[model samples]
Target: SPHIVLSTLTSYCPRSPHIMSAISKAKKSADDARDAAAQVREVLDKIRSALSHHAHDTSLLVRLEGELVAPANDVIRMKTYTETAAKFAGHLKELSEKVGERIQLHEDTPASQRTLNVAFVARTKRNASQIKAVLCQAEDTLDYLHQQALSSYAEVVLEKGARVIEERKEERKEEQNRQGKNQS
Candidate 1:
């Protein structure tokens, strides 16, 4: 009797094209978001590595100063990756919202007449939540890395400035010594 009822409901209730299109878009967005997240993770790892190396050796900061100026450096790459991931995340969020609206529409249907399986709806909700969580994490990581890069750049400038001041002081002392000797 339950099987008969399910068959009758399935035959009578055709799936909406909008719901099908939303599902297709959600799947594609999820795949693209995953790829973007992976790229951002790689950028984060490179930033961590550079920061760790600089921590172990102050001279590495000088090297970082040069790398920062380069076009293809980790900081620049991280920015690009993070931007791309953020775009994908936003798109995915929109798609998930559409899917949620479709699910709500199905849930509103009378129990005996509902075409969507309860378990299927629950699983879809869980998947959307998980994808959002992952993308949020990637964005957070990118923000942290960007901050680190800024801090590193500031330190390098300060170090260079202090060195210049010391050199000028040394030059003044040498000039004074020469003038005194000549007067004597």
Candidate 2:
């Protein structure tokens, strides 16, 4: 009777708590990531909207293209902006790669007899594509973000470098003056 009772208790012990905990953690992570992705997606959407509005309101896009082709003072500014934009663009791209790795991790989960279903595979494929599309747009938006960030950085660096060089020149002049006074 003791052995029978022990066996029954063990058999009846709930597996739900452990399973639920895992599911809860996964759900929390999914929600957090989705929220973050939504924020980034909104940014990308706004950028696209702004570009469309600009093109609609003015022929800026067309005229800008013409200006871009001609050799002018703007070329240096453009090149500087381009370099900065590339750096931000790289950061955005890195974020996209993280999303992709997460998606692949989800897709790679092994099927089990206790929870196996064809729908799981279907949904996984659908979600992967949707997330991939969002990531791609994020990469595209990086172009604008990079340009803005880089242009600002370039300006700051130029200002700082010029000031530093000027300060060094002044220091050299001061040293020469001290040397001349000593000689006199």
Give Cα distance to truth, residue 132, candidate 2, Å.
Answer: 7.0
lDDT of 2 by residue, 1-184 (tens): 2224323333433333443333344334334433433444455444334333542221332243233222222222334345533453454545345445534544566536213656555554454454446446544544454445444444443444455456567878999999999999
The positional error of residue 155 in candidate 2, measured at the CA in angstroms, is 1.9
Write candidate 1's Cα lDDT for 60-107 as tens digits.
423432332332233233442466434445544453454454346445
Task: Name the top TM-score candidate.
Answer: 1
**Clashes in model 2: which pairs?**
84-150, 85-146, 85-147
User: lDDT scores for all predictions?
Assistant: 0.44, 0.43
lDDT of 2: 0.43
